[model samples]
Target: MEEVAVASDGRALTVGSQQLAHSLFANYPLTAAFLSFALAQTLKVLTTWYKERRWDAKRLLGSGGMPSSHSAAVSALAVAIGFHDGPGSSSFAIALVLACVVMYDAFGVRLHAGRQAEVLNQIVFELPAEHPLADTRPLREPLGHTPPQVAAGAALGLIMAYLMHVTTNLSS
Candidate 1:
């Protein structure tokens, strides 16, 4: 059985409503993670535009920029879980571990990969004009976050989760 509520506008909302808005807003952790990801991505876009003085829509979809979206998402999930289920709970512990692994990968393995790509790109650029691969498209270089970017993302996630938790508590 699903609970139903009617709004002042005479609109009916159900607990299991099939609407996209309803479904997305109904889950706290998911909402927090999504918001964090959006914020991080938006920040990347804005910062890139500010520095480059040009609007690059690609930044919105690209990865490996300042404020790692991966870090923001996992950290948001972990913090939200911590708030919903006591920090000492198993769920929180799992979320924390997951966040740790994601942040580690962003800072370590992915960063190294990005560096390697840069080196490869340089090698390709230095190749002779007559070389078959000389004109190939350069590799994507911004594929991992620096340590500061990861830290910024983690902080943003924690702040967003805390705000969401507070607002949810207040509304309830």
Candidate 2:
């Protein structure tokens, strides 16, 4: 059975557990990343709701928010790998490098692409109704993650990894 630990704020950590739930509980790093991404999407929906005072199904799929989900997930995975495999481990190194690349793309290339899409969408929206381009709709390309979003994700992942490691150690 894996040992479970709780933080002052009630967060949990575990190394490994025989029970399915407990075993799954140990994988907090990955879960945290996903939760962060979900939070960003939810925020976008809320923002839209506030502006329009109405529900927008499109916001659910819209990208770009306080934190980048992609960055969060990959960074969390890297942090988890680092914790599990050791900083110097080849697996951890690979994961860390991959995470960096992913974050860079999300904040740099993908972000610019989103901006380009936005400008293009604006142009499309301004087209005259009688123009053939009037039928072209704006694509919902995401603005990707910001540097702070990526950094926050990295922090969250590291914290989760550490907590998991500590709990596993204490439980044993």
Candidate 3:
């Protein structure tokens, strides 16, 4: 049996005599998931610039936007796996469940946490200067996605994964 090593970055699997390596785009599911994530982040930047009339590069790496990047990525991963491995396969089932869990958490638990943070921050800001906790930094309030945000992200993910699947699989 050949001893093989999986790359830490998951870009390739290496055999003793040769290296099988390629760009991220070469892998259908991986590419779909990653590109979906990047596209969602880029969209956040654009939406911020349009709505706020300011360019906020930080949105590219931040959470909570018109579309949830977390939802986009996981949904794309699930769909892509379904396409590549067949919807009835174990891999596809795992991916689909993971996507559902992530999206649900984004809409429910995380959203509540962000809202709570906003309230706490307001309370802190109203505290008297002499209070012991008055100087605490405001919490990060944009930590989750609303229902519409999660829906949009899931739609984007489905489209992106379909496109990636077609292009990658058909062309090969």
Candidate 1 regions exceeding 4 Å error are: 1-24
Which TM-score value belongs to model 2? 0.68
How close is every model to the real structure, measured as TM-score?
Answer: 0.85, 0.68, 0.89
lDDT tens digits, residues 1-172, model 1?
Answer: 5667766379986755455467568678889999999999999988888888888889889999888999999999999999988899998999999999999999999899999999999999999999999999998888889999999999999999999999999999
* Tens-digit per-residue lDDT, 64-141, candidate 3: 997899999999999999988899989899999999999999999999999999999999999999999999989999
Better of 2 and 3 by TM-score: 3
Regions of model 2 farther than 4 Å from truth: 1-61
Clash pairs of candidate 3? none
What is candidate 1's CA lDDT for residue 166? Answer: 93
Best by TM-score: 3
The Cα local distance difference test for each model comes to 0.91, 0.70, 0.89
Clashing pairs in 1: none
